[model samples]
Each structure stands twice: as C-alpha cells, then as structure tokens.
Target: MCSRLRWTISSDSLRGLLLACLLATCGDVVAADPAAVGAIAVVVRNDSSIRLMTRDEVYAMFVLDRRGDFHPLDLPESDPTRAAFYMRLAQKNLTMMRALRSKLVFTGAGRPPQQLDMPALIGRLAADHTAVAYLPASDLPAGTRSVAVLQPSP
Candidate 1:
C-alpha cells in the first residue's frame, strides 16, 4: 500500500513556518531584547554644576560635535554597553561612530573621546568635575549622578 499527502501553504503561512523554525533554533539570540541587554545612563560627578541634559547634547558631547568645557569619556569599543549607548542615544552603531570620528580627526574637526574601562571611567568621573560618561544603569557609582538615561529604540 502507498499513501500520498498533498498540501498547500500560502506565502504568509510559509513565512510563519520559516519564522517559527528560525526562532526555535535561535530563540535565545533573537528573543533577547537589545535594550534589556544593556541600558546606558549618562553620568557626571555628583558635585558638578551640570544638572540636566538633552539627548542631543549628550550625543554631541560624545561624538565631539560640540565644544564645551565638558569632557566626554567613553568605554572601550569592545564593551557591549558602549554599542548600546551609541545606538540608543544617537542611533549609531560602532562602525558608523568610528567612521564619523575618523572623518572628524582626518579633517581636524575633533578628536575621539577618551576610552576607559569601568573602574577607570568611574575614577575619572569622580575626579574630573567636567567629565561625563555613560555607565551601565545597573552599576552607577555612588559619587555620580545620572543626567540622562538613553533607552534603546523599540
């Protein structure tokens, strides 16, 4: 005895099936929220005069597009939170940021911000009244105050 099965799947149905299979195999990766992976909090020393900042101000400071007494610090490019910060605040990825900075440097427009590890960044923030940096929201230091919280785009 032989049996045959015939079926048709609409384009939407096929797409849904493919999506389900992809999710099944890569759910942990795809299902994870980019914003939830790491939210960034822009901070300054507690005693500093700076109180509030808009997102544009933060982005300008970070990208060296604005010249002010403010000193912008940054985490190393390899740090995951760094990527999250730029993406959330400026809608930029690491490559785009690097390219923009390079162009600025090449044209003598501005220099890239200083890169530091978490401890070093904390120390700088505490020591330099003009310093501003983004830290993982979950780990903000005691002597620092958040100026803005850059949440990832939905």
Candidate 2:
C-alpha cells in the first residue's frame, strides 16, 4: 500500500510539472509572434513638406546619427508602444537602444530624442511641421500623417 501511494503521488507531481512547462512555452510562442500585436506607424506632421522616408532614414533619425532639418520625438521608455516602435522600426530593444544612446552621449557624439507623453506628443507634432514620431497605427493623432508603416519581415 505504501509503495502504491508513493507511485501515485510521484505521477501526479510529474503531470503537474509537465503542465507547467507546456503553459510557459506556449506563452513564449505567442509573445514571439509579431502578428499577434498591432502595427507601428512612422508619422510626421500633416503639413510637413517631407512625404516619404525609408526604414534606414527613420532609424538614423531616431538614433541621432543622421542629423537633418527635422526633429525626432520619442515616447517615454515605459510605454509599450514605444517599445514596439523601436523593436519593429529600428530593430532594437529598449535596453539595447538605451545602451547605445548612453555610449553616444558619453562620447559627446549625440543625445537621445526628447521623450513625451501621448497628448504632448500629439500636440507637438501638430504644431511643429519638422517633428517626426512613431505610434501604434490605431493611436495616431489627427494632425499627423503616416509616412511609413513599420512591420516585421515575414
């Protein structure tokens, strides 16, 4: 009886462990699928003379590498939309981006883009024709026009 009871308990524990592992792996798979999330839009002020930009141009502008007449605006680091924007458009995660920006600042090569909340970002874009930013397609404000849609490569 004692041996039988031990076997039953061991089997139950193994089943529970397997279940936990499956659940964890499934969550990771879902999160890794970019199609599961909304698309990101690179935008400029509606009245801006610049109508188009390539992915490289957008990336350079964001990283403060290619200085142009236009200004780049960023959402706060904690915002998920900002994270998605960097990941999709610039092929960078927030931690990597921060490290790069820090190195640039330390070398006096460049500074990070100005961070703003959603409302302030919208307002600034509306008023400044030279300003550029990225936001979720659904969340783009009225006075901004999407210059490019950034998506994961299939």
Candidate 3:
C-alpha cells in the first residue's frame, strides 16, 4: 500500500514538473517566446516531398514507429535545448528523457534524433528533405524554409 502511494505521488509530481517545463526551456524557463518558436525551422531530406508542417506534424516528424506517420530521429541527450524541445512533444516532460531514450535505443524502437550544433543542424536539413530537424531563426540555413512556428510539444 505504501509503495502504491509513493508511486502515485511520484507520478503526480512528475506531471506537475512536465506542465512547468511545457511553459519553459529545460523545465526551467518561466516563459518562452512564441515568435522564437515560430522562427524554428523544420528541414527534411531532398527526397521527401513534404513542404510545411503544423505542430502535430512536427511532433510526428520524429517517430521511429514503422506504422507512425512522420519520420522520427533519436538524438543524444547532451543538448539541453534540444532535449527540452523534444520533451515538449515526445515525452511528457524532461525528467525521464535520458532513461527513456536509452531504453528506446536498446529496444530498437527508433533511432535517436541527430544531435547537431547550429551549423550542423542547418547543413543536415539542407542536405535532406526526408530529414526533419529544428534550428533557431538566427542561424537558419539557406534553402531551409520556415515551415512552421515553434510550439510547446503537445
């Protein structure tokens, strides 16, 4: 009975933190600029025919499920911003991310998202239309279009 109570408590606390992270970066920021999110770019491989995306579309972009709609790529957990961005949509929040991604990597559930610095992120996106990843507007790569605005991953 005590274990169950503890589980419930943990779950509730986790949900609360996730909600807070949904509003910020790394579960730390109190607020995020909507325009900043909008300026985020989604790039795909040249082979892919897709053009623009909605928030849901962006979320779907990184799923490795064969039956899934969008192409999901698993990236390393080193970058806090990318991790937070991923948690904003993929996971409920940021807490379980490393464990979750590690588990996923082992299970072959999917490949990790490509971890790229600003230049790499732009270069990768520019090279592939089927490859979808995000980059800030300040460093957006040439040939990449602002497909959609940044949104708290729902």
Candidate 4:
C-alpha cells in the first residue's frame, strides 16, 4: 500500500509566500544585456560652464553628496535607464539607493534628486544650465552634452 500526505497554508501564510516570490522576482531587474541597455552618459546643458565630470563626481552628485552648483536630475523610478545608471555607474541597486535616500531624508541630511520624465528632464536641462542628468547615450538630446560616458562593467 502507498500513503500520501497533504498540506494546506493559511491565508496569511499564502500572502506572505506570494509576497516573497514577488520580491524575489522583482529584485535585480537590471537588464542583463549591456548592448540592449546601452551605455549611460552623465550630461549637462551644452552651454554649461561645467564641461566634464569624473566618475566619482558623477556618483557623488547622483547620491546627493552636496557637490558643486549642479542640480542632479533623476529619471523616473520605473525607467530602465535609471536602473542601468545606478547599477552600472554608481554600483548600486534601486533598493539600496532608495534606503539611503530615505535615511538621509529622515535625518534631515539630504534628499534625492527630483525624478522627472524624459521630456521634463530634457526641458529642465535646457532651462536650467545647472541641471545634470544621465540617460542612454543614444537618447541624449541636442540641448545636452555628455560630461562622461560610463560603460558597464565586464
């Protein structure tokens, strides 16, 4: 004779399991193909006085390090370019970046850059020469020029 056992989960346990699965799947959403994602460019208005930026400077600016007179603009949280920018250049994932920004805001230290859509971000850069941002190299607008081209790590 053969015997079998059955198991059942409570609603709370089912919800928790589903949540864990969702989080696990959503984590590390960065694109695996570098070519598909394209290199990211740290950019400023074409006529800005600030010509170039080092990798460290770019990373600091994005992380709200209180750098020079530049205002760092951020793409929307759901944008793939935003994910690539943080993952490739800053060596950080969205979760870590969000947590850091939250802590900074809580402690009254600093706030994350203003998130904007592509058109609004481009407009801001055009209007505010102090504005700096990152986007896929191919998508860079004529009003902006790349200060630094950050390639993905091998």
Give a tens-digit lDDT track for model 4, residues 1-154. 2356655331122445767687866754554543357788988898998888888888778876575777888886667788778878667777988787778667877667867789999999899999988888888888889999988665
Q: Which candidate number maximizes lDDT?
A: 4
Clashing pairs in 2: none
Please identify model 3 stretches exceeding 4 Å from their true place. Answer: 1-39, 45-48, 63-80, 91-94, 152-154
Q: What is the C-alpha lDDT profile of model 3 across 43-154, one tens digit per residue?
A: 5554556666777867655543332444333333344446556655565444565566467667867654545555665566666565666655455556655565554443
Who is ahead in lDDT, 2 or 3?
2
Candidate 1 segments exceeding 4 Å error: 1-36
* Residue-wise C-alpha lDDT for candidate 1, range 63-114, written one tens digit per residue: 7658488878877665778877877877777689878887887897877776
Off by over 4 Å in 4: 1-35
For all predicted structures, in order, the TM-scores are 0.74, 0.72, 0.53, 0.74
Residue 151, candidate 3: how far off, in angstroms? 3.8
Tell me the lDDT of candidate 1: 0.76
Give the per-residue lDDT of model 2 (tens digit) for 1-154.
6666643221122455867686754542213434444878889888998798888888888875564788788876556777777778667776788788878778878766767778898888999998888888877888788998887456
Model 3 lowest lDDT segment of ten = 6-15
Q: What TM value does model 4 have? A: 0.74
